[model samples]
Target chain A: MTTVISPPESPAGSPAPRASRGFTFPTRFLPVIATIALFIAMFGVGSFRYEGFSSPQTLLSVLVDNSHLIVLAVGMTFVILTGGIDLSVGSVVALSTMIAAETLRAGWAAPLVIVTVLLTGSVLGLLMGLVIHYFEIQPFIVTLAGMFLARGLCYVISLESIPIKNETFTSFASGTIEIGDYFITPSVIVALVVLVIAAVVLHMTRFGRTVYAVGGSEQSALLMGLAVARTKVGVYVISGFCSALAGLLFSIYTLSGYNLGAVGMELDAIAAVVIGGTLLTGGSGLVLGSAVGVLVLGLIQSFISFDGTLSSWWTKITIGVLLLVFVLIQRLFTRRTT
Target chain B: MRDLGLRFVRHNLFWPTLALVLLLLLNLTKTPDFFSLRLQDGHLYGSLIDILRNSAPTLLIALGMTLVIATRGIDLSVGAVAAISGAVACTYMAGSPDESTAGRAVIGMTMAVAVAVLLGVWNGFLVSVLGIQPIIATLVLMTAGRGLAMLITDGQITTVNNSLFAKVSTGFVLGLPIAILIALAVFAITAVLTRRTALGMLIEAVGINPEASRLAGVRARTITWTVYVFVAFCAGIAGLMIASNTSAADANAAGLFIELDAILAVVIGGTSLAGGRFSLTGTLIGAMFIQTLATTIPTMGIPAETNYLFKAVVVIVVCLLQSPKARAVLSVRRSSPLLTKGSAA
Candidate 1:
């Protein structure tokens, strides 16, 4: 009868396989439904309370401002989908900015510097990946070491912020695409492209499904003759690459590479991914949800700033409460399915 | 007997102990008087004493974290709880007209500790009853905790002018810092509680394999629940000491990265993140090693900011050595007949 299954995708949290099931939930429907509803409800409240809140410009601005975070959440989604995590993203972003700023100042060509930064990121991810897979150290600890290494390397480069005044970088950051009365930054375009690419790879490609299968049951995936090692290691590489890109965008946005940039941003990315209906335990989630998650976070900040009288920390509280509610919902569905 | 010698070499405490000793020796090289203690105004003081005092909070948090890790769990909310307790205490004392009153100090501390205990219960309920990942569960509080703390102090840094309350961190008992005394008492009590009761074994069993332990009649849930509560309490107390040190509670920054330090200490002390076997002594050495390293860079004439760089190096070296693959290769080289001959020497 195709009753809800547990721990395996006989009814895995993916929305793909449950097309014909009418009696039960689309299964992935619960969390996804909850997230979308919450976003709408919050958006409605904002539009009702604050003037011009529902304007196209404010929505566009949300995407423009959080473009860096959007990219980060995408990377975090990949890692978490595999029941793994990458805590080094924030520090790597900081390192990226530092490297970009210093190299740009040293008269290096922007394109060459960009390639070097992304390559450096991939290499860092590769090293951590190799250590995790071969040495079998926990991803948490290894990424933590990566975090410390990246941050420490940032300090080694320079103890203070290095302003990015390079012509190409600044112009790119300043340039915006306009549509009628609304405008969006190049950073948002880049973030959306990355998101689209990630969604395709996760949904369409063999390697992508392998990620889900591996998360569903590594043993079964291995037994099915999948290249578990490469896929596992590759997810981290993707994360590292994304973090570096985010860093490049951040440098362009802030026009400087401060040593303390993006501190505790990993938590923010994680919170967004989780709140967007991505299962923390792996094997379930949507990339677009992570995008919405970032928007929700950005909206929370907007809500706080809009009120003016509201203390800034209230944003943190709302995020926390949302996290609590969504996480509980996740538990309910998982338990009932069991 | 020869096997026993190898066991000592393989002991989890071996590397951390050596690191601590070497760091101290390095400090000695810089200033011959580094270890020299003095009786100043009826209290002992020295670089060594300063380290003990500085690391007390980390050590206390690590002590609690050790138990939590032993149960296959982690508490990311410690930093937030630290900030919260400190905020609550400082806010209470600041609101009082007679801020210097010892009674007010006592009441504030009680309230702070009680609140901390409640937070721990919340963590316990989440982990035990809700079946959530410890990291994700505590992360909820970790994210909101500073906000709660800031809310308590009305989003302002709470500065209290209470001499009695400040004594919690600053006062001396038997010529030792009271903070260290409190940490040591907690450590001793934890040691006794774990080692002297069946509780320790139960915790290990659950950590090693929760399902198997459950099948074997262990209350794995209770163990997990209690450990989280305990760790939160420890973090809360650390917060109080931290606040007293500055006589102010900057909710956002008070215990900002201390959870990472405490977790790092626990990991460095040879407590595996995988959970199962744990060593409190290793945690002690780990905390000491970290505190010493933080000071060592400046003393060695290196920029103090590069401490993280050096720490990254040390963490990598330590983790590599502990990796099963690395150990397997080492054992293979040792047991090889030809390779063992002169190389083993």
Candidate 2:
């Protein structure tokens, strides 16, 4: 694990490095700024090209449509920042959705159902984190197993989609407040709260800083006397909790819990995170960037739908291309900075 | 006796082979006629034969995966590559004026495999040339390859009408399943190609320490690029087998989860995910074990949805059992006096 690039000792005196630095903004905010610009550009293009797109309602619709992704991206930000991954998040979301729907259907209270789903997600995450930390297995493998386990559990609960009939849950799901020409739902609000809290924690809190330290260099973090192990495990738990919350939101939005729900949503989240300018190799990302990333993807889907002739698969291709471009950009940025 | 048992358990191939054997024994106990093989029209027919036949696709992919992982890389796009290959072949055959001819099928397969090679080169370019992380690089294709497949098939499941194509998966040559024979042939070729040359050693050297190998004058980039291409070729063959088996190509579903299954096989076969040494024989047994488990799951009376749950549990158990910490804990009081300190945890 040698450091591929170390910071130059004399940044101010080198001509080639100076030229690149002059062409670029601060390296830390370069990706986030690029992401915001891309989102705005995409949204602007969609508004001008697509019919019925130039409205606040449509803007709100983007958030509404991608509420689950927003939450998942935030959670994924934490895991990726810790140099770990959680492929289980999507499956865990599906499992939580199934549990929420089933428990709600089984004559249970909304509070009880919510707690059970959240608890299930947290426990599963904690277990995977423990295996990854204590057993010294790779995060990818552990989370992969977790993904299978969660998906399998979803099927065990019910092979068919379970529709929510709980009155309170339905009301909460459908309840929205009109903000001028646009509207926002309870779920959107929840996602925003999670986003803000995540941003603050990541930027302002010791635990979040510790997560960055661990991802930056585990050995150094340990030598610096940071709680590397606990932070590593805790990030996973936070991810699990976020995934469950997202699952709850997805279930509410769809009002059904199918085992096959969110088949490749985890990939979508990862794609959004990368497009939003997070380095996949870990260390250095922003939560707000993930939110913007989700919007970019949502806007792409919206434009595709509006076109009427294009297939949904085009979104996948677009995301793939975006992922490639962003990764290359990150590479250039890191090379210049270091 | 104790020493023999210790050596056997400690062997890399032991657990995977033992797992395969135990699965077979489990099948035998449940059905009582599981191991009974009979000749049907000069071809073998039985559970044992079925395991070999069914595991061909997985075996091919895992064989390639063994090499890929051995180089400290992973190709998540193998499943997607399988889909694209199937789509290309099926679409080509369906459009052929004389779809029934073996010649048309051959051309279609060649074109399909050629596309797969191109795709593999794209992956290799991103990884070796551009220096993108292997997982992220392959992930680009993994995300978009299916879309490419769908485009090739015009968003439909393309079914070709060709006996020659069907024969690729179902037909037997010299009283052996064609699929099984193809897998073994590929295995034998790769075994000889790698073992008989410097390729295997070079791959291991690159996997162990790329910088060190480069400094030592080994052509690490060439080795990495070759393995990626080789892996894509294997996936292409597997795609042909899968499509030929069904006589149709479903872009959305063909080779779904094969990457995970292949990775699981490689791990179960005792190949370290961290790279360095690999074992083709171990991967063979590991693939067979998975196919057996796939066959055995339905008989357990569990719901279909919970099948993956069972697999997850078993995979976790196997991985944990193979983990250095778990092994140290288990063998602590027996042999090594410093076992307690050796466990990383």
Candidate 3:
């Protein structure tokens, strides 16, 4: 977590820093700006077309419904930033819920079960990171194997859905903070806290800068004396931890742990990351951008329900289109940066 | 003579072949007649044949995947492409009579492959023309292809009762399953196309270093584009075989996770994910190994769900053995597979 680049901060009056201030601003922020604009346009269309769409609760509900996704996207943002992809997040989420449910059924305390689930995910991720590093294997293949391992472990725990009926677990799941008609679940709060922490770590700390550096070019990062291997490994661990946390949030929402739950949720998280103006090739994206991407997806669902005519599959197709546009945008912009 | 014999023993396929044998042996403890083969209705029948039968679709996809992987690109959308193909074919057949004739089935399949080919072109465009990352580029189809399939099928599992259509899976030729024959034919053709021609070397060159290959007058872009199209074509046929097997196209479930299986098969066959230097023969063994494992799980009376767990273990073990670090730890003095095969990579 130590910053390698924070030492010898450029003095405030350094002519180099002052000269380029805001010079690269337009192209750099274009995708995020475009994402925010599209989100607003989509929200505007929904509010105008549907009754009760403009209410405060609609946005609040979007946050609550997609809290797990937001958390997953936050984790995905970290991995994708380092030019690596973790195909295992969705499966890890499933494994976490399976473990949490089974342990609780076996009379384990709430705190004990939660810690166990989180530890299981991190350990699995750590092993994968080790393999990826030591073997000099591609991140794509290593994570694909991890995906299989985690999902298989879920089946090993239980093939059937296990319901969580523990008093504390269910209570926390149903608990909500309110402002009259506007309300939020504890899961949403947790997701937001994760986002803020990730943002700070990514932007305000040296570790975060190192993540971007690694993603930009690992060879250059190594030449610059950064811990490329550690940063690469650390991102996967963070992703695993986030996936487990998202799994907890998801369990609260559904209160049931099914083996097949979140089968393609990894795609959703990756889609959110891409849509939030983050480049798929990595090194240039924002955690907050990913949060907006989640909302864009959530709003599409809201739009579908409001119309009552569009099928659920439209969400996938629409997101794919949006992702295409954003990718093209990022491609064009990154061409400029490089 | 002894040196040549040692080199054969040190071949890339040595371990995977052994692993397949070991897995087959594991089945014997439970099935006792695991290796038994009999002629039934003038057709091959046995656990061994069944393994081949079950793995046909995967073998076909893996054949395509091997080439794509050789080009330093991957097609994660193959499963979705398979689903779409099945949906298209079944929906076409069901649009006709329930007892559709051979022409109906052929036409439906042709249309299905056509659409799949077009989808491949889109993927090729994104990757080769637009300069998008392969993983992200094909991911667009991976996400939308299912929805497209559902749209094609009206979100229904289109069922066709055409006998000729079902024959793709159920029919036999010379006492062998037709599906396996098709897969084998494709495998042979791919070998000839890649190895017999300069195409294979060109692909390896592109994979090893795209910029250098492009500068050396290699048509890197076209080769990349063609490889993707070939994989989608393979996926389309595999999807049709799957639909023919069940006589239905469940857009929701058809070809689900087959991409993972194909990728695993390719890896298990001694093809590195880093791309270049592929072995079709190894893929054949790997696909059979996976299919055998599926049967082995049920025969052992354990929960069938642990199949994924077993697969994960096999993948890890295979990868570890391939790793130079593991090789050093185990003190195997064999040349590194990467160096021995394609040092240019």
Best by TM-score: 2
Q: Per TM-score, what order, best first?
A: 2, 1, 3
What's the lDDT for candidate 1? 0.89
**Which ten contiguous residues of candidate 1 chain B have the minimum total lDDT?**
B336-345
What are the per-residue Cα lDDT tens digits for candidate 2 across B75-167? 999999999999999999999899889999999999999999999999988888888888889888999988888989988999999999898
Deviation from native of the Cα of residue B249 in model 3, angstroms? 0.6
lDDT of model 1 at position B133: 90
| DockQ, cand. 3 | 0.66
TM-score (chain A only) for the predictions, listed in order: 0.93, 0.94, 0.93
Question: Considering only chain B, what TM-score does candidate 2 achieve?
Answer: 0.95
User: Which segments of candidate 1 are over 4 A away from where they belong?
Assistant: A1-25, B1-4, B333-345
> Tens digit of lDDT per residue, candidate 3, span B189-214?
98998889999899988888888899
TM-score of chain B of each: 0.95, 0.95, 0.93
Write down the C-alpha DockQ for each prediction: 0.69, 0.75, 0.66
Q: How many Å off is the CA of B145 in candidate 2? A: 0.9
Clashes of each: 1, 0, 0
- For B225-300, candidate 1 gives per-residue lDDT tens digits of 8998899899989999999999999998988878878888988999888899899999999999999999999999
Choose 1 or 3, whichever is better by TM-score. Answer: 1
**DockQ order of candidates, best first?**
2, 1, 3
Interface RMSD of each: 1.2, 1.0, 1.1
Local distance difference test, each candidate: 0.89, 0.89, 0.89
TM-score of candidate 2 relative to the true fold: 0.95
Q: How many backbone clashes does candidate 3 have?
A: 0
